[model samples]
Target: MSPSTQRITVGELAARFLEQCGVRAAFGVISIHNMPILDAFHTRQKIRFVSARGEAGACNMADAYARVSGTLGVCVTSTGTGCGNAAGAMVEAITAGTPLLHLTGQIESPFLDRDLGYIHEHPAQLAMLKSVGKDAFRIRNPETALATLREAVRLAQTPPCGPVSIEIPIDVQKMKLDLPADLSPLAVPPVQPNLAAVDQLAERLLSAKRPLLWLGGGARGASAAAQRLVKMGWAVVSSVQGRGIVPEDHPASLGSYNLQKPAEEFYETVDALLAVGTRLRSNETLNYKLKLPATRYRIDANALAHNRGYTSELFVHGDAEITLNALADRLEGRMQIDPKLAADVKRARAEAASLVDGTLGQYVKLKNTLAEVVGKNLWWVRDITLSNSMWGNRAPVLDHPRAGVHALGGGIGQGLAMGVGVAVADAEHQLGRRTVSLCGDGGFMLNVGELACAAQEKANVVFLVMNDQRYGVIKNIQDDIYGSRHAYVELHTPDFAQLCASLQVPHFKLADPATTRDTLQKALAHGNGPVVVEVDMNAWGPFAVKFAGPPKKKEEA
Candidate 1:
């Protein structure tokens, strides 16, 4: 073919770039402004675009896809309103440090800065996107489109990764471009830690009698190194996002119960703490008031993350995987294992698990039933609800590094959309693995339309809705703070079974905890598409432990 024949439009080149980056799937809604790019994608047929009912759902799906697949999650949306709709999901992705590419379409080049009305125009859209994403860019010229996209992808995938947004004008998308013979995806190099800092961290680990390893989402890639430390008799605790980093079933793993009292007691026994890839966020640290060991050391990709939450005696700036590998290499065969310290870790692990399980009480049956029926290929996803706050976050056993995903930003409606994204990615990547999303009725109602998106795409997701018929957490808060005077918390739910029927999704209601396993089995039997299993929390009775808001005053006590 001639050089002219090899030429392609900017939109076509963008699609080709994504294909080169190994992106097999994307999520978005069709819009007039984005037609050129969508047309190119449709003609190429290289990437499967899962059409979403809303832009928010599309972005959430993309976020979850990145979390599960460890690749750049792609979402396409129109400019202005579509981008605005996607902002909340972008925030969730930012909080989770998910690598996501949000490709959006802007008005034609000629209509750039005019106050004259354009169908989907919003002033300062780039600024709005920057507020939500790690970075935002505009392709002012068709020649720079590919380079802009390359930079966006690189930034999104870089350590301390988050979402990146790029806007292409309609005219720019349509402009024809010469295809470069050597077009290749840009490679962002990983950041390496200072050798002196690594040595200092090793010295700290070698000297401690009772050492603990605290893993966070940033440490997910360092699982092998974390396991080595665990084998070296280091106790392991994880933030919720870091749940599967050490394998929750391991004897030393404390899972996501890091903020509880038993774990707090265990913290007192720790002499040195090796906190890696975690911010030790305020929520996980009991609003930064939870006591930690005196000699704390931190390993993170971002140098600025040091002393953000708790002060660390030493801070090593590098990728978690690299830093942990260095520590493992330096400390191997150099230190003596303390039998008493190992025993203490085992005891602390057991006590923490027992205390959490005991607090679940009646909810334990439901938890066990899900655990028994979910099998090994489970991705435990949850929404922000009373159950998640109480036990759901820490209850499930995740075997793989990316086996658990949730709205770490405390968003409510994202679980359903995220589950769809995860299930879609799982089907394409790890077939037969189930994505089970636990959501409350109130939260479920927030993005309920995404269930249709799941059904439309034939995603293998089972949404287990804990139907308490009210904002359970808010009700508890009101009950504690407002002298049991309930107002506006109760909500009348639609018949979920019928709603599922209308959306052509299989539905199951668990009114009795006794039938939980069987109901889950039956619901999951038809694995052709998404399923909704509603657990009637009211019929199961109140949770064993109640939310009592803040602590009471000493005088009141």
Candidate 2:
């Protein structure tokens, strides 16, 4: 064989492929089944392999890494239970449409799919991965390893992107293979929009007196295009996953207050609704009961998204970035949007912000304090918790498309792990940015072990643990509807100071709500590694507007 195409283990080839793909870092727990691949990573020292404490945390890290870095996030895991552990995180990646590659190990080729109870072997592991991932594949032999990896990455990075899982058997990973001469990764272009449809939509939008644009996570790549539409007097709002596509602080933006009373009222005056790259999810749309404009249009890469949740007058199947650019090109300077629309949007946003501030009650200080500290400079990562559901999701306006990273799947306990990933990405790019992860006492304890990983990596993160010592949302629901007979709501919360002490992480306690800003500043001052700030929510008092659950459906007369 030529010197340029020397024989090497498939494991080494996988590592080289990832390097060629410009993958800077990967995350997962190390295990014997996947040792070959990790060994290759270690030996080459080309890519940073983060050793997470659990497979789930590893996968979450990878997902957030992809979201923040705008690249294919790689995760490695062992076979069977290890793969199972990563399943939930993969689901989140799929929900968020993150471009991620999940590489996992499998049992030996001889024992695979035999159900013989071999060590760490799983029955139909690929099927489980398929259920959780956008797609799943397996390398049956050494010769097919590169081809399988290439296809998996392609499918993952394509439009309507999502996590794709590929399992390599232990034997195949160790087998010798000839390296390909051309190791550069393949490029998959975004789906082009249908120009005729784009022109028709542009004409319709031009005729409207008041037009609005709804952006979602898929719209992140189309920020400039979306901004142009906004500049043309189009009011804008976003789904939770879609925050920061256009800066949340933009005058015409309603932010993620889609279901708020003022925004809902503003929607009635909208003559044309162009929903771009958003699902119009049930939660944000008040279970699809929220009334929108009469003329509604949708643009998305997935053709099946047409009429999902809310029916659209027209469905344009193409990538958000591509289609919006085409539409913006035609509609520029020609739109007949109402002159008062921008002022109305501003009024609505003010009302919505007032409502949120009132609901925050004593915690409004926390929100404002964080806004001062984060200030579009740090990555805002939050898990599904009462604080996030109440205000964390909206406050502290994100200016850039990649500034916000949350659990889009509504999964709890993901913030800490995701914070590590964001910090890693921040450091990897040398952006000098830090991460502020918001968590509740309930969710913080779920994957609390990841704190060790954060400390070990010396990640730049400030974990704001809201210590209420109970499932605050559940208890609120009980109070509102279940006669306050709360069960499974109280938690045996840990002393965060002692916990962080053991982990060698700086710990701060915020008992006085007035000191919110100072406490956060001090946390950020601990610049070298991860720090935990436990907010005493019990002392902070309750929100003025109690969030029992989703809006109650009105009874038919």
Best by lDDT: 2
| Candidate 1: C-alpha lDDT | 0.86
lDDT of each structure? 0.86, 0.90
TM-score each candidate. Answer: 0.96, 0.98
Residue pairs clashing in model 1 are: none
lDDT of 2 by residue, 1-557 (tens): 66677888989989999999889999999988788899999999999999999999999999999999998999999999999999999999999999999999998999888888999998889999999988999998888888888989999998789999999999998999887787677789887888999988887777988898999988899999899899888899998888899999899999888888898899999988999888888778777888888789999998888999988988899989889989989988887778999999999999998988988888898899888876787789999899899998888898888889999888899999999999999999787767999998888898898899999999999999999899888899899778989999999988888888998999999999878888888988888899999999888877778777656346510
* Span of 10 residues, lowest total lDDT, candidate 1: 548-557
What is the number of residue pairs that collide in model 1? 0
Off by over 4 Å in 2: 2-5
Which ranges in model 1 have alpha carbons more than 4 Å from their true place? 1-5, 548-557
**Predicted structure 2: clash tally:** 0
RMSD of 1: 2.0
lDDT of 1 by residue, 1-557 (tens): 57455778888888889989889899999898788888988999989999999999999999999899888899999998988999999999999999999999999888888977877888789999999999999998878888899999999999799999999988888898778675577997878999998998898788777788999999988899889888877788898899888888887777777876777887898889888989888778766778889889999998889998899999999988888888988988777766687666667767877877776767888888888888657888888987887778887788788888998998888889989999988977765578899999999999888888898899888898999999988888777778989999999999999999998998989988888789988987877889999988888889877755322333553
